[model samples]
Target: MALLAAFVGTPVAAAADDPDLTSFYQQKLSWERCGQDLQSGARSDGAGQPPGFRKRLECARLEVPRDYGNPGRSTMQVQLIRLKATGPGKRLGSLVLNPGGPGASGVNYLIDSGNSFANLGRRYDIVSFDPRGTGHTEPVSCGSKLAPPPGSGADDSLAAKEKRINEACGRYSGGLLRWVGTQDVARDMDVLRAAVRDDKLNYLGFSYGTKLGAVYAHEFPRKVGRMVLDSVEDPTKNAWQTALSQVRGFQRALDDFAADCTRQADCPLGTDEGKAQDQLRHWYQQLSEQPMKVKGETVDETSYVYALREALYSRSDWPALRQALEQLRHGDGAGILRLSDAGGGSAAHSDSVPARRIGQDELPPQDQLALRAISCRDTSERYGADDYPRAERELTKASPLFGPDIAPTLLDCYNWPAAGDDASRDVAAPDAPPLLLVATTNDPATPYQGAFNMARELRNSSIVLTYRGEGHAAYTTGDPCVQRHVDDFLLSGTLPKSHTSCS
Candidate 1:
């Protein structure tokens, strides 16, 4: 998810002797058309304002302080986009959006899927922005040389890669690395709320965006307007806890996909779910020992494992997964490579064959580095190399397929140089108006339990809107019930009674 700020007509005046951010708060924004020929990579200019771009989207840049504490010294430009309300009715204020990825560009997300919010946009301006260390927002880069090449998943190798990544980030990220945490982003949101002239924040955040929204509500409860947190992230979870939960969640999602696949006539893993899971595990083990060559490209254990996890994110991708597994069973790595590509595996390692174009929702190298930097800085958890053995055993016991892979990821934060001041705090927004929490029961990314936990944390001020389906999030997945509730809340501040289920 993302946060944005802009200075309209008059600059927002700063406090008399406080943080001296008045100049930044008062800077004006200029918008220009954008998103013409987006498929071919055409974009706006340096100011992020496209000249004569034929899209309704208008792009601009918001200059926020690199460090709010030192507002005048240096600044980072945040990319912003706006889709004005196409209304026949009374217009509400801006409804800002964040599409999860601590790395995802909210500006691009709104450009691609603005119509999804048409119902709400008719009543409110739809606004989005690329948060710090993300697209066009003074992005953080840790040199691709430090990035682990695709299929390189050995424990020792991963540890070495993590070390290199840490060193590289420290070298290249400037001092902005420590300030990119969600807390900092939330502070940016407050400045944005004021600049946009919204009395209160009206926001819709998905996946990681939920965490951002919750932080915002906690930090500025009174400034929160109608908010929807889809696929909620548990604010109470430390990094290790969050990783473990995700391991188990992905395992459950894989099991569900495997079970459903067995019912299909072309199911490659056969009719027995247990045997199929074992087959997959065996495949991973074998690939680890001897990488397979398919379509003139190598398919290693790490790639296959990541592909499986990716396919499990949504049931709609199950068909492709099944085909990939079938091809794997037949000694053809082509399908596996294709699935890996879909899962954000590096294209450099992929074969030159013309594969179907998967949506480029995958984070760029800089964005991925930023994701790690922000995540490491935001949480207090520090996992050392020695902590892996016990964690591996426990995680594997809980989730045999995904545990091993997920456990090593914790090591990335080992010996992280930057430290964040905002420890995990109680997210109870007692003073905030009603908030809506949306949870997909079988969500693979943000597990359903996190939503329940967030609802409880927020106490009576929040309502949990349950989508009894399988996916990462609820809204825009063709669930009219979910959309209706979100629209109602955003349009009229209607909060469903606690624990309302929309199957």
Candidate 2:
């Protein structure tokens, strides 16, 4: 499948006088043709065209050395998209963005919401690309195994279900998972940078994308021109720590949601905020024993309620949560399941949604072994057999909403073929460029503390702004303060003072 590419490109040549690309690549950088069918002046659809959005702009594949360490025999194509600046002369450079998820496609991101980048789209050429094994870039599928349990509730047969899914994932995703690590994505970014002939790369990443941005900074610090990492993830923390922190984040958000619900008369939980929480706890305890019967469907405690809570992580979906809760209070599980499936469904189910826009596929079936190998080789020593139960107990106390899934998801890494990376590496490199990190005080997905840690480690960097609101990322929600701060930094290279707050 050909990757969809977008964004504008300008002709930029390396300075012959400079020893390395430092002068031209980092300073006074310009865009170039990327040497693909997606030209500097126009757009083209390359491969893997989605059904309805078939006419969406296409991309050209620029084959790069699959492994940077061994550039000779290996090769992989990194997909790119470009949307030229709307305002002429106002254009300075290209602004690359990633919408978190690690699996989110940059190309489709520009397609669906490119305009949200007010003042930005006018001043800089906007471009996004699918990282390798993502989107149109030779995707990675864990086959049908990693798919969410069908319908609203999980399979009652836990052991058998887990064994089945794990075996399927292991079998279908042969070796691609190993190469889907951040390092590989970073290399793709470098290739995209060189392909466009940019002197320096300006980046805006959210959630998991922030981790990608951080890794890129560490790998190619000098190449970083202006970076805004919103809803940041800490590069220093191991996957387990990061996941555990999300448990707390999700709990806080749940509290906030429950409190808000009390203000609404429609809130079935109750008008008293504390009472509402108690009611929720009671509901979970009750459902754990006797699952609810919704439309003749057996709605289990773990799947249904947790799905509703997860939906609350993004304010944009709060209304749906309210509706789901109302439906559940009346004994209807179908609505909640549908909503959850829409929001959390795997690629196969949501294939109708533009592959590049809704989400990015983690790894192709071919790379699972590689993903396991690299992750285990990197982070194996950090976990033990006791980790799962410990995480479960700890998370249960953290938040009633996400406690169950948070720990289990993280613990999956403990049993993963590859444990994890040596998170001990010094994440903050002094040589790295000044970075703008954005954090939400109550982000359920990435968590705020992780953002703080990322900022601390990137000593040269500054907190462009922190959102006091709740959500995974404020940029997509059109937070004025976030939008402005990002615009200023990318357009003018100005960073807000330390610990800046966004209303």
Candidate 3:
């Protein structure tokens, strides 16, 4: 299939008449302190309010072409949040970061994770952005998330719901729906790199951000400098294979969590392995029949499953998953709801309603919608009603626990109104400098094996940094060993020894 979807490359006029992109690349951003503009407040443990903005964080908006192929046609506002380097040492220019949501808000990530990179921040300004179709960057939404209207037929088949979602997305996403793919975002990053006055792009990305970074390296090989891709995603896998791989990883983590849960006296899942499995399945059935209320939101099987799946991303989240399950048993679902509201980066799901603007507290969250849209746009594969059953069957066989919940997601691009491209399906950046890819041996979201594949595909332009631990990404796990290796690379371009593994 021609990778560029129907919406791509069709000249607004002709290729020869392309508008000058010099202006877009040369524009300067107006930086200001982040406060109410981003609903700044210290992020509490819960998801009730937006996270607190750091006192010294600077925020700005960047303008790039909505469609780079036709820069003169329209433009998009990319939201940027930065924490300047605290310079006791020499400045290392700007180290841009992407918090791995093909749909999540890097702007929010900058606020939440800015301090994690304080070590790097001493010499490099930590910058992050909300890419198109995510967060505050003209997010693609499926209208307002309204419950199905009364008499809205009971055909809740995945095909039926996906059809509505595709319709709603096409209805609301406008011209950018098909353009939010990683290929486009990489171009935007290049513009960002130029706008920041940096000759090369120094980047840190997690999960999907790794894919984005790899795409960037492929596009602008010589422009890459000191890049880190944590929780590397396999570029070889199609959307279906990626889903199956991730499900297996999560199921393994779930099993491990269950084993540990039974050892605890207060484990909600109880001590018997068989009983624990049965009990959790029972919750799925129970929630499906009678959705519980928490914070005025319904906690159905979909939300419950997302909550469970997200908590599996890191070992640190296991305790919260336990609490959410415990609360579920007690008919108090705030814990589960919190996880649902906070889930994204790799995979997350939600419902839809009438149209709604991208703003604070929008249901389904911009991240999930962006994930669905961008995932479709990045691939040329389009499933019909027929493909759903086969995909679901294979997915279920892969992991009985999460397979069913994740199966419906196979059709995320079903009859997508806009055509998609396969530009990201394959990446070849032979000219790019060696990239440091951090992979956890037992990561639930982006499995470890994929890291090897990604490195091989980068045509050996990557060295794997293995973290023999549990988590979604290593840098945020407070592992001094991992941090030491990463800092060493970014600080002085020192590569860790071959076969380096940190506990």
Candidate 4:
């Protein structure tokens, strides 16, 4: 509350006056040849790629407030990429995108999947930025290895580990920890909208990005143009509720996987649902007693659960998950370890893979730490170790396979340095134009209910496109039907009928 009080008393103009951000909003970017060190996806349109499109990507940096309230205190640069529209169609200004991950890098996303934006790219300049505390935009750093060695932390209490992380972030992170919340990022988005010269914000945000997009709508409702939120998160849910939702979501995906697995003759989980669940639970017990090693890294019960949770985000990974589980019975830990190290190496974002880096492996340590920094700062929930046991029992009962893995997330904000504000979660954009929300029924990261919840909060101004499918996102799944609706909306501002469902 003190944090909020300090910012609220800033007169808001103190920032613009102190830092004189009018200069920032008026400054123009100097584009240059992008470096391979930065680019993630293939550089150009591949064979059979989208037509009328070629990658003319360029990179630049935009200056923003390190502390938005007291902008004169400091400044930080936001890394951004632009995929100029290639089509002969009349330009529709700049179309900005955020690929969820409150911690995900939009710069990498645009460069990696430039071709995916061919349709919109031809009509609008597709732009993305690495939000603060992520990518090259002054990312959060924990100074040391985030987790204590596999078995070493076992002796420490849960709160001790939490304190260790809090101390490390407080020590490092370049003094940017307190300012990386979604509200700050949304403020950055407005500056981004201005820097790009877009009269209004046209955006595509997925997962946590949806939270970002919705907050932007609330903050700058009149400035919103066409917006699409996929794999949505219910901003109203605090950190603990969000964690609980993910637990249930992962468990639901597991049941879905189990049901799908039994139909296969070579199913490792067996034919009966009951037996399949029992088998999985039994493997958890087995892995707990005898951890596996792969490529010089330890794979304990915690890693095993994470690997499974990672696979549940997309059905495409289910085959790998099955293979991993099968190979586990045969004592090979390589497959599951790969999945564990997958998902952009971040902890929570259910994003399958970046646009350009197919079969990419090894998520950066910073991404994992950034997730904690941004999520903790936005979430006001300050769960203590005393609260862990009850949440654990409840989550475990909800999902014996995934609950333990998620229980620890509830405590992420315990000793966080910055105080979280309600503005990040309040998405009451009553005056904003209608927005499109694409949600998948079986999404494990941002459950479908979150999308529906978002629509409700938007005051019935959002159209919900339900894809009764699996995966964390809908449009990226290559479902022509889903893509058509999204393309039509982004390209021509068409909205599917309300309560529309696509299989």
Candidate 5:
């Protein structure tokens, strides 16, 4: 989930008849400064920040109740970054963004990647906010131990590191983890809508952001005007179901990679597709038995395998993978080590151990128990403790490279200490707006099929908008067909017929 924008209107206020509503639509709001006056419009960098373009966007802060159930309690300030509209008339309020990770910083992303939305900012205000506990918000922290070590490779030593990470995430993620789920975030968005004074919300969501949009649409149907959910994941799926599908998604990407690698001249795994696949499988096995080392750093089979799977998430990283494969073939570990460092960090930017590096203002500590409680409770599928070992074995059989991580993630969930009864109640209301589901044929995370299934479940959703391309979500950088469909939907309230494929 990422955001982009241009500002369109002065903030105002609107009232909802529901007295119990914690959020309402409002615009043209005037806040008095304490002896200092700040401009009342949006802000940006004021330059052509190419590719996505940049603007010295406007910003403001809104006070929100710490708990929606009680408005009179403690309050927290939510920061907003806006890209104002170049249009003249009273333009649409805003198109806010969120990037997945449930942890990724939307404001930072918009600042870094806003140029990509060169065409979208003309008509609407592009706005992004640091979600609760995310970057710059009341950030979550894991202390010093959670930082990823620099570099990567295949070494027997990393098994301990992986275990340490899991343990640290469990221990340091305090009660805050439970509150960061999509449901809670949707509530946050509603508050944002009210604070910004918009009768309806327009959104463009990517990956996990799609889940956020889906939850918002379900909870506040009337508030949604237009939305585009790219690389959609069905929130209704249980943890096991989600993991199982992700395994298959990676397999699909792997197959695509293998086929392409065989056709290339410098194919590191060699020209024979079968041979390349065999070499990859054998390499993982070899790493499991004896890990490789880089600059005295040892990485285990699981770390190397996880890196490989994670690398497939972007086509940009494919070249790095090819180089890593070559190193693995020659028994050198430097390339993989580099990949590991890029993905994992031993410390936050603060040079402290990762757990402590992230400031408290960025994310609230997570409650693993509560996280499991909500996820399991919301999921219809249940797994017994004994079920994991068998499931892990089967998952491994599906793809050796990704299986270990997927299995471990699921096993962790199975053993989750949270009670599942709360989420057991159904939350999806199929009668929401006609959702526009977009998916890339080769998304490594939430695959195309996942979008297909989601579209199937939501009767009001348009047919899946299939982008015959690679990468996670294509709404921002997809082909013209994909882009126009999204643009049409977002700007004109038009939905694609049945299912549309953008090749």
Candidate 6:
């Protein structure tokens, strides 16, 4: 697959002349085979690498400055994993990937699903790295003690909790806290791109990753080779706007789920979609008052809502969600508890959804800390003392089941000490080659409209590939049409015709 023949190029001289980054770009990666059994560790010494070497996957660490602005100060290691191209044809450089969560382990994601990218791997070196402050990359640790207890509902008290967390992170992470934003990561990607000998970046990013890719393209348009942003996030939205949009998107997904459930004989939400939502609201209220006990653990309103949010990320998990709701109604809170655990990165499962336990899938406390730290510092939106009440009201109006829960979490940036840089920008990458934007109609995390908004922002330089379906991301969802379009785009610089829609 000679994807993007125009993208082919000999290694360009280091993209930057900054003395601080000269060594970084010149550094060579000593790749070593890594096995699947390796536990995901927070250190950069390949502690996450399996005990015995394996030929299929290779791991390496790249050193980058903790603060690019003050590169002389300190440095951190970014752990990366690669599955080299197994090609009979000419290799097409590296295809970097990120799996969304500001904290998700990209290397771990690639290791778990390397085969899924085999088609591309045969033509490109599939590379993924743990971004700064995540996954063995000098992880940011605020300590698990600072985290709110499970099922802790959104309330005024959360402000204090967030303040404490911010303080802890500041104390623990020191100067590294402010440098963990998406912009910093985008710059890091450029350094990595040069280190890997790719003259131009070939990248695929999903969810939060979309934001990263957009920032990268905005920052280094000329370096962008072939880029794909799936489940697109709108860069023009402020923090509050993004959160509110997600709250509404999730509600829409729930409504869709409810409507689907009504068509089933064993639907626990009942036949009327509106009534079904009301039932869910009532259940949440009841759980708020008294959490249901299951296997010595309790399922509270926050847990239930978060679990539903996670299950709604993909349609494949809908059956599990239904079973969970049914089990909850029957006085067995185990199902919901498992779902909540799964949402929190646990490997718990029910018959409906078979959960795969990746070593890095279960986020450690440090990764969670990194997620909050990066998110708070990357967005310009902050909740003020007076904003919460207004937000709560609007959220409840937008979504009865998810509004109240979703609204309070935004308070995370309220007391955060690290200031946010504006991550939302109008991306104009005219020098960059055309890119593909994948969006699902009812994507709960990054809503569908975001894709259109991003497409409009990119203008003629981008193509919108719409999947008229439900799910957070379009590709790798077992949708042949979506896969074919993506494969065609990534494998050959063939852009889908404008306004291409897939089912």
For each predicted model, how many residue pairs clash, with residues at least 3 apart or on different chains? 2, 41, 8, 3, 72, 3
* Whole-structure CA lDDT of model 1: 0.72
Better model by lDDT: candidate 3 vs candidate 6: 3
Give, for candidate 4, the lowest lDDT window spanning 10 residues.
Answer: 352-361
lDDT tens per residue, model 4, 1-503: 44433322221234333645555566577777677667644333344545532346688899988886666778999998888877798989888888877677777666556666677778898888889999899989877455562463463676667766776788876478888988889988888877777767899987888888999998888778899998988866766677788888888899999999999887888789889989888888988898787878887777778788778877888888989889887888888788876765222263222111111112235666677788878766788888989988988888887777777767766788777766677888988999999999998888888888899898847899999998787877778898899989988899999888899
| TM-score per candidate | 0.86, 0.77, 0.86, 0.88, 0.76, 0.87
**Per-model root-mean-square deviation over C-alphas:** 6.7, 8.5, 6.6, 6.4, 8.3, 6.5
TM-score of 2: 0.77
For model 5, residues 1-503, the per-residue Cα lDDT tens digits are 01111122211232453234333223233332211122211133434465333325566666665565555555566666777776754576678877655455566656655656656777787877766666555555555545544456522233333333444545665444444455656776876776665667799877767777877877776677787888887655666666777777788788888788888887888889888889888877888799877788776676576557656666667888888888777888777766755531100111000111122123223422222333433443445445767767877777666665566445333433223342422335465677788988888678677777676655565557888876676866536888898878877788888767887
Q: Which stretches of candidate 6 lie over 4 Å from their true place?
A: 1-20, 35-38, 41-55, 147-156, 344-364, 423-426
Candidate 3 RMSD to the correct structure: 6.6
lDDT score for residue 209 of model 5? 73
- After superposition, candidate 1 runs with Cα above 4 Å error: 1-17, 35-54, 147-157, 343-364, 422-425
Best model per lDDT: 3
Task: Write model 1 residue lDDT over 358-443, tens digit each, in one string.
Answer: 12122235556667777777767677767878888988898776777777667767767787554534677777786899998998
Q: CA lDDT, every prediction?
A: 0.72, 0.60, 0.77, 0.77, 0.60, 0.75
Candidate 3 C-alpha lDDT tens digits along 1-503: 13322212221232566666667666778898886668453243323322443568898899989877777778889988898888889998899998775776777776665667888989998898888888788888778863352365665665756666677778777567867888889988888887777778899988888999999888888788899999888888877887888778878878888988999888999999879988988998898899888767788877777787767777788889998899889888889888876643322112111011222223344567787788888888888789988887998898766787777667777878888888885768898899999999988778899888999998845899999987688888888999999999999999897799999
Best by TM-score: 4
Q: Which whole-number lDDT from 0 to 100 does residue 448 have in model 1?
A: 88
For candidate 6, lDDT tens digit of each residue in 1-503?
13322233222333466445566766778998764444343223333434421357788888888887777788888988888888977898999998777777877677555566778888999999888888778788765455443464644254555555666777777667788888889888987887787878999888888888888887787788889999888877876787788888888899899999989998999898889988888889888898888888778887888788778878999999999999888877788888777652211111011122112112235556667778877866677667778888988899877788767656666667778867536576666677899999998878888987887776545988999998776786768998888988888888899889999
For model 1, where is the 10-residue window of minimal lDDT? 345-354
